[model samples]
Structures are given as C-alpha cells and as structure tokens.
Target: MRSVEEHQAVVDGLLPAMPAETVPLAEAHGRVLARDVVAQVPLPGFDNSAMDGYAGRWAELAAADGSPVRLPVAEDIPAGRTDVVPLAPGTVHRIMTGAPLPPGADVVVPVELTDAGTEVVEIRARPPIGSHLRAAGEDIAAGTMALSAGAPLAAAQLGLAAAVGVTELSVRSRPRVLILSTGSELVAPGRPLARGQIYESNSVLLAAAVEEAGGIPRRLHFVPDDVDQFLATVRAELAGADLLVTSGGVSAGAYEVVKDAFATLGTVEFGKVAMQPGGPQGAGTVDGVPVVTLPGNPVSAFVSFEVFVRPALRRALGHASPHRLRAPARLTSSLRSPAGRRQFLRGRYDAGEVSQVGGPGSHLVAHLARANCLVVVPEDVTELPAGAAVDVVLIEGALQ
Candidate 1:
C-alpha cells in the first residue's frame, strides 16, 4: 500500500506532455492555444460606421444649426469594400451600419433631426459633435496580443481570430486515449443480463472522462477475466492509443485478470491507499503506452479517474491546470477515515458550507450520484467535528 501522495507522485512521472499543431480557428474551439495570438490586423480593419447616419467633421456640426449641407454618398461604401472616396466638402454621406467612413469625415449624425419637415427625401440630423462612430484600432490595434498561450479557445476567441484576419491558429493536439473494461460477467447495456452478469458501463464513462480532458478516445476494448484474452486485447489496443485506461480487474481478487497479467509482465503495480472506494490502484506501461488501472467499483473508478487519470490526460493535451478545484469550506458534520490515509468523502455544498452527503463506505454508488462535492479528509485525523474547516472539491459550483 502507498500513500495518496506517493501514488500521485508515481502517476505524475508516467507521461510526458504532448506537442502542438496548427488548426483552423473555426475548429480551434475547446483546444488549448500553443502560442500567443497576436492581432495581425486591427479590429474593424479601418474607420467604419457603427450605425446608419451621416458623416461630417465634428467641427462642422458645432459650427452651425441647420447649415445647408450637400455631400454625395461617396462610392456608396458598404461593408467589405475598401474603395473609399473622400467626402465632398460641405456634404454628408448616407452611410449604413458597418460601412467604412469616407476620408475627411470626423463625425456622423443620425437621420432624425432633419426638421426639414418632409421638404426633402433625405433628412439630415444636425448638431451632433460625435455620434455613431467606430474608430480605427478602437477594439484592437495591430500587433497587440489578443490571446495568450495555454488559453482555451472559446466562441469569442474564434470571433476575435476572424476579426484579426486569422482563419486558423496553432493549438495543442488532443491526446489519444484507449479504454479497456475487463470483466467476464460484464455485458454492454441494451442486452439481457445473465445470472452473474453486469452491464459494461465503465468504457462509456471512461470515454466521457477522456473527452472532458481534451482527449480523443481511439477505441474501447472489452476484455474478459482470462489473462490471455486481457493481454492480447491490451497489446493490440496500445499500438494506437497513447494512453490506455482500464477499469476493474486491478483489485486484489483471486480472479483479477489485470493483476494476473501484470504479475507476469511486470507492467502494473497493484496497491491501496487510505481513500474510500478508490483504494486499489495500478499503473505502468503496457506495450510502450502509459496505462492506468482503476478499481472495479463504479464510484471508485470515477474517483480514480478524477484524481489521477484526468490530470495526466489534461497535461498530455497541454492544459495549464488539469486537476479539480479544491476550496476551503466548513464541514457540516463529523467524518471518520483510516488512521494513515487521505480520504475523499462524498459531499454536498450549500451556502458555502460543505457537508458529508453519503455513508462512509466505498461501494455506495447512489450516494456519489447525489453528491456534488468530495470533502477531503486528510490522514492522521480521527474525527472532524461539525463546522470544522475542510477542503472540498466541487463537482459543480452553485449557480451564481
């Protein structure tokens, strides 16, 4: 048995970080940027109208009220057209939204205050110093750092790239993951279960975990308890996936296929910690691909995924901070755990205080589902009185 920190240290050194690649900005969503994104071109590119109004010098508008003004709609500047003609002296251009401002124009007046009283078809709103205008380099000047490396691309980022004339960007590539669910009594969902059979939910769950960590799951191979079958399947799958994730078969049971196979190849080391549910753990390289073997219990499997595997996968995909968030909060009730092991207690958080939500047992699956947090109880503390300060990892924070 190893301490939680010990095993975590072991898992940390298992895999190296992955590299980056260039991807289209449209496809950059959900991917981490490898390099800083500098704005090659200014946002809006040039001075343009932010609204449909008239363009004139601000000094000219301040000069007089109802000053007779006549200016041609120079070149009828629409969006995406660069051919801008200068504004004729003492004339206003009938500009539309997003149209480039004509040269020698400093202000825009909306078509509202014409007071011409239907005397003319195009009424000009007068006496506005600065109205309906977007200045050049107002949003972003050229050569500015728009986004930094390691930032995840969002919708706004994509729009920024498009605005800066960047159709594609370089980003970290998604890690390749292979899922292995080992059990003889396991059957995929949508099938009839035999007397001792259970549905194969680990692969699906593990695949989702990998996806959340920015990994591309290559394949999910189901292996039975037999050693020969397990070894064959894992060896075959490892050829493609950069990381191999296996659920179950790592526990200390007489018929544990993962332990049995690892005994011969020495590719995995089975051990336990003081944590609830996710006690049994194993890790090593199988056919040159990093392998993480989790306990069979569903809650244990998921906990192990969050605690160890998710961070590794995230680092492999180039994320800055890959682990779950741990925050300080007062415990609502007392909790107990083993003498020399760190415990992750299933919990719920409300009003900024976290409380243990489930019985202190490892196999309690329903309790985990009802829980939104994992209250961290460190080793060496026997009992925690109600209202004691403890660290908690929120599965979902309260809606702000």
Candidate 2:
C-alpha cells in the first residue's frame, strides 16, 4: 500500500548516477556526459559577413546620395581567408559571405547595391557596427560550459560539443541488461503455437525497451515453468550481465517458478504491491548483481519498464532528470480504479484531450498495443469523469 511517488522512491534507491566514459562524438549520441563540456574557443573566431555584401563604414550610406563615393577597392576579402587587413581610410573592401571584417570597417553593404560606374561600386546603405557581421563568440564563448554532466547527449548537444572542440566526450557507459521471460505456455515468435502456448512477446518488447533507454540488452533468456530449470538458467545468464530483468513466475500461483526459485537464493524479494495488473513486483541482487522481476502480463511488463526499470537504468547511466513528463489532459471517458491500489491505464491522446485506447484491465493486449499514453488514476477516491483533468504519463516526445 504505497503511493506512486513512494514506489518511485524505492526504485530510485536502487540506482545512483555515475560518472561517464570517454566516447567518440559519433557514438556518444543518447549518452549522458560525465562532466560539463565547455567551449575551448569562440565560434566564428572573428567578425565575418553574414551575407555576400560590400564592407564599409556607416558614413558611406549617407554619402551615397551625393556623387558616387567611388572609393578604391582596397582588399578583396572572400570566405575562409583571414589574411586581408581592415578597411583603409576612404577605401572599400569587396566582402563575401563568411569573410572577416577589416579592422577599420564597421559596416557591410550587400553586393546587390552596386553600379558599373567604376571598379569601386557606389555605396548605398550604411550597415550598423554588428549588422550582418557574426562577431567572435557570438554563438559560443571560450571556456564556457556548453553541456553539463547528467544531460543527454542529443544531436544538438553533440553539435555544440563539436563547436567547442570536443572530439570525444566522457559519457555514461550503457548498462548491460539480460532479459529473461518465464512461462510454461510460451512459444517464440514466428513459429507454430500449440493449443496452450502463446507467442513469447515480452522478451522482444523488453529488449527493445532496454535499447531505447540506452542499455545494451544482451539477449532473451526464456525459462519454462520448472523451478529448478529456471533457477539454473537465471544463474547462467547473470554471470554475463550487469543487471538482470525477468517477467512472469513471481505471481502467487503454485506454478510460479520464479517466486519459488528465488525464495532461498537471496536474490528476489517477492511481494504483491497495492496496484493492478502490475501489483506484483520484486527486486534484489543475485550474486552481487542487481535484478528486477516484473509481472507476466504484457501490459504489466511494459508498464513496469516505464515505471521502474527505465528510470533505474537512466539513473544508473547518469541522467539527472529521468522521470517521464506528466502531461495533463481532459479525459474523454469515465474511468474507475480499484479502491486501494493505483492504476496505469493505457490510452491514446490527441491535440487537446484523451480517450481510453484500451480497456483498463491489465490483461488486455490489443488495447495496450494501440495506446501511447498511460492515464494515471491515483489511489484516492476513484471516479475520473469525462472532461476531468487528470495527470497523464506522456510517452511521447518532449513537450517542446
């Protein structure tokens, strides 16, 4: 009988943020940095024209009304060449895009405003001191922290790292995960299923979830409902993984192989939480390595990943803020939950409000597949009416 936040606290205690490893910029995507990434040098390095335009002092724009200010074209400054000196007095510089501004010039006139009067074009408008010119450090400054430790190494973050002279960065190492599924009536996918056997989909789903959360799922270890065999298989898989995650066999049935096997191994602590579908949860260390065992239902398994395992992995990999964003939306239909335990209802949401995509039962798989959101109905007094404001677990992209 714990609140959602309380269970979250228990899960959080299982993993702590750790330092990062140095990885090549290309491979560092989606990893968290170990430390702050600061700029080694200013971007743009110098004042350069933002456009292919003429360079001149502001005084030239006012003088354009008079007889053409046909000044001598002092130095031709093209893009990528820094050898040209500043504009000389009473002289103009033919500047191209990305070309540095001469030391003496404080303005730029685009190439379109020109005449065939002489080799030197007539000046028209006066560009301000910083107009069109990208001054040094305008984008980024030297020695400034661009990416902080525990922040995700996203595409934009990587680009910023490169701008700051970071060829490789110290990032969090992806945890090696071993996914094991237990059941007597489970058959692998793409095969002929028997009368009592169902396709084993939890391993595939769990593996993908592991990869998406930045962990490396070694492979699936499927164990039939034989207690001795399950125990033996789990030991063999644990030897190679940093952490182990298993689905099924933790429930209260006599055939619950997982619950019985771990009763003496000192690895799993079995308990039925005050929640639906996913109420059964267990976690502990087997031979010094961390392991979390989830309920068998497909919806329960996926929800367990979102609620418990994913955040744990993220925290272990050095994520500062690892929880999903709770987006508030109006419920389009009524919902009722068990009086005591909290519920995670699978749902689909559109622009403004949300409608239940699947039944509230944890056993419903078709509805779970169509859902992209989890409508969080708290343990408090229970009816969530249509158009009611409820907190929704948004599995969608970050709310930009």
lDDT of 1 by residue, 263-286 (tens): 788877778866766888999887
lDDT agreement with native, every candidate: 0.76, 0.79
Task: Determine which window of 10 residues in candidate 2 has minimal summed lDDT.
Answer: 116-125
Cα-based TM-score, every candidate: 0.81, 0.92
RMSD (Cα, Å) for all candidates, in order, is 4.1, 2.7
lDDT of 1 at 293: 87
For residue 27, what is the lDDT in candidate 1?
A: 84
Tell me, by TM-score, which candidate is best: 2
Q: What is the C-alpha lDDT profile of model 2 across 82-173, one tens digit per residue?
A: 58886777877888898888887777777766662235677644545557778889887888778888889899999988877889999888
| Collision count for each candidate, in order | 2, 5
